[model samples]
Target: MRKIESSIDRRRITNRPIAIILAAAALGLFASTAVRADDSVGTVTQVNGSAQIERGGATIAAQQGTPLKLHDKVTTTDGSVTMGFGDGSSMALSSSTSVEIEDSTAVNGQNVPSRVTLISGDIHTIVPDKTGQPHSIEVNTENSKATGPSPNQ
Candidate 1:
């Protein structure tokens, strides 16, 4: 009976550290997810056909009103999606396109710094008129980079 009790006590001691480690890991994972959820920069205003949003190694269906965060990748298999940013700028992605939201922020209600990489296919953007402070929208492709409000403006 003494030996059996000693063995049981040892098992409890061994299991406690493992349980604590697991609990800590779970809490860390939840904290990171919460941070990502708080950093949304845009929303899927319209989605046609099939689309997905990839973030943090997970791919989720992209539907109208889906929030988009910086570093999020949006892919369209057979249709298109439109994303609208807080600064009133919007992007319309064509079918078979993959784009990553690189950086986006609105500062002082006057400037919106935004960029997207066009992995394939095409994207059309309508940037709202500049409000005094400089606004930039950079579209990058495999072979080219386009900056908007064209030089003619």
Candidate 2:
């Protein structure tokens, strides 16, 4: 019985380092997820023809899986483009359209507002309906500004 107790104690002592390592790894994974959440406000799902994304004065070709950040100006030439946002919102822009992302942030599972400026062209936006949780988004056109689909929508 004494020998068995000693073995058990040794096993428990050895397991402490493994437990600590596991905890540290879990914490790292959580932190990485938090970092990844801020990486992009949305993503480019499809680009029909030619689209350009101007970020901080640098223009890049927009393609599938391209990450979109805040203040990104996207313009579509010959064809249209489609984008999916973080807060269950999607936007489809027709050809000869220009849009700028004003603000978008996803933090700690909170629903925040996003703003977009439609410099030109036609766009169809869809925001999810979340009854009590109010999620608001706004779009600005050349002449007027309008709110997107609210929580009721």
Candidate 3:
């Protein structure tokens, strides 16, 4: 009876550490999963390149390879600010316009939703047909949100 009890106690002790380790590992995985890249914002190909973008009374250049985020104010000095999307879609920010790359994501690893908020300016875009899934392109103005050209248009 004594030996059996000892074995049972040892098993319980060993299982506790295993369970703790597994829990820690799961938390680590969850943290990493949330730190993914914002591919929908795509790459900046023209920062301070030629067009001077001013935000908050500061002039910042929009260059290629810059990772844009939400609320990053952007404006064009001479030409339009261009941005590429993961689904081959793109947007051109008109001069003297303030645009923001709001919420964008490639959810479920299936389709990407590229959202842009034009606080006060104009945006021209080219939407793509991504496979069979419905791709979304939303543009928000001061008073309204507009969807891109219809799927058939």
Candidate 4:
């Protein structure tokens, strides 16, 4: 009887710590998912003709004010689009153009240097003028890279 009682007491002590650890892990996982689900990097400001956005392997029609997330692929099927990033930088994609939002970090209403990759077609980028403070927009194309505001049309 003494041995049986001691065994039961040890099990109870061990199980309590295991249960606590599992509960804490479950809570941490839930918090991480909540943070990842709300990550929006930019938005589509204008869409003329037809445009689509590919996110997480799913493609959806592009509309004005459509929020853009990191690694999203934008393709214009029959029209053009203008995307305004969180940093106040904009990219105008011509008809039949495909581009990818590479990286963008905003500070005080301006992109420290938001970037995009032009897979095909033309794009016009306009970045905020913070002359002495240093602000820029980066564009990448096949075989080359361009930075700063420029007209690619």
RMSD in Å for all candidates: 10.0, 5.5, 7.3, 8.3
The 0-to-1 C-alpha lDDT of every candidate, in the order given, reads 0.78, 0.78, 0.60, 0.75
lDDT of 2 by residue, 20-91 (tens): 999999999999898766647888999999999999989999999998888899999999898987666778
Q: Write the per-residue lDDT of candidate 1 for residues 26-142, one digit (tens) a residue.
A: 999999887655777879999989999999999999999998988999999999999887777788887898998888666544323377777887777776666533344444354
User: Each candidate: how many clashes?
Assistant: 0, 0, 8, 0
Which is the better candidate, 1 or 4, if ranked by lDDT?
1
Instruction: Work out the TM-score per prediction.
Output: 0.61, 0.65, 0.51, 0.59
Better of 2 and 4 by lDDT: 2
What is the lDDT for 58 in model 1?
Answer: 100
Clash pairs for candidate 3: 44-64, 45-64, 46-62, 47-61, 47-62, 47-63, 48-61, 48-62
* Candidate 1: residue pairs that collide: none
Candidate 4 overall lDDT versus native: 0.75
Ranking by TM-score: 2, 1, 4, 3
**Global lDDT of model 3:** 0.60
Per-residue alpha-carbon lDDT of candidate 4 for residues 12-113, written as tens digits (9 for 90 to 100): 898999999999999999998876566677788999999999999899999999988878899998899998866566788888889887786757643433
List candidate 3 stretches off by more than 4 Å: 1-40, 46-59, 107-113, 131-153
**lDDT (Cα, 0-100) at 28 in candidate 4:** 99
Name the TM-score of candidate 3: 0.51
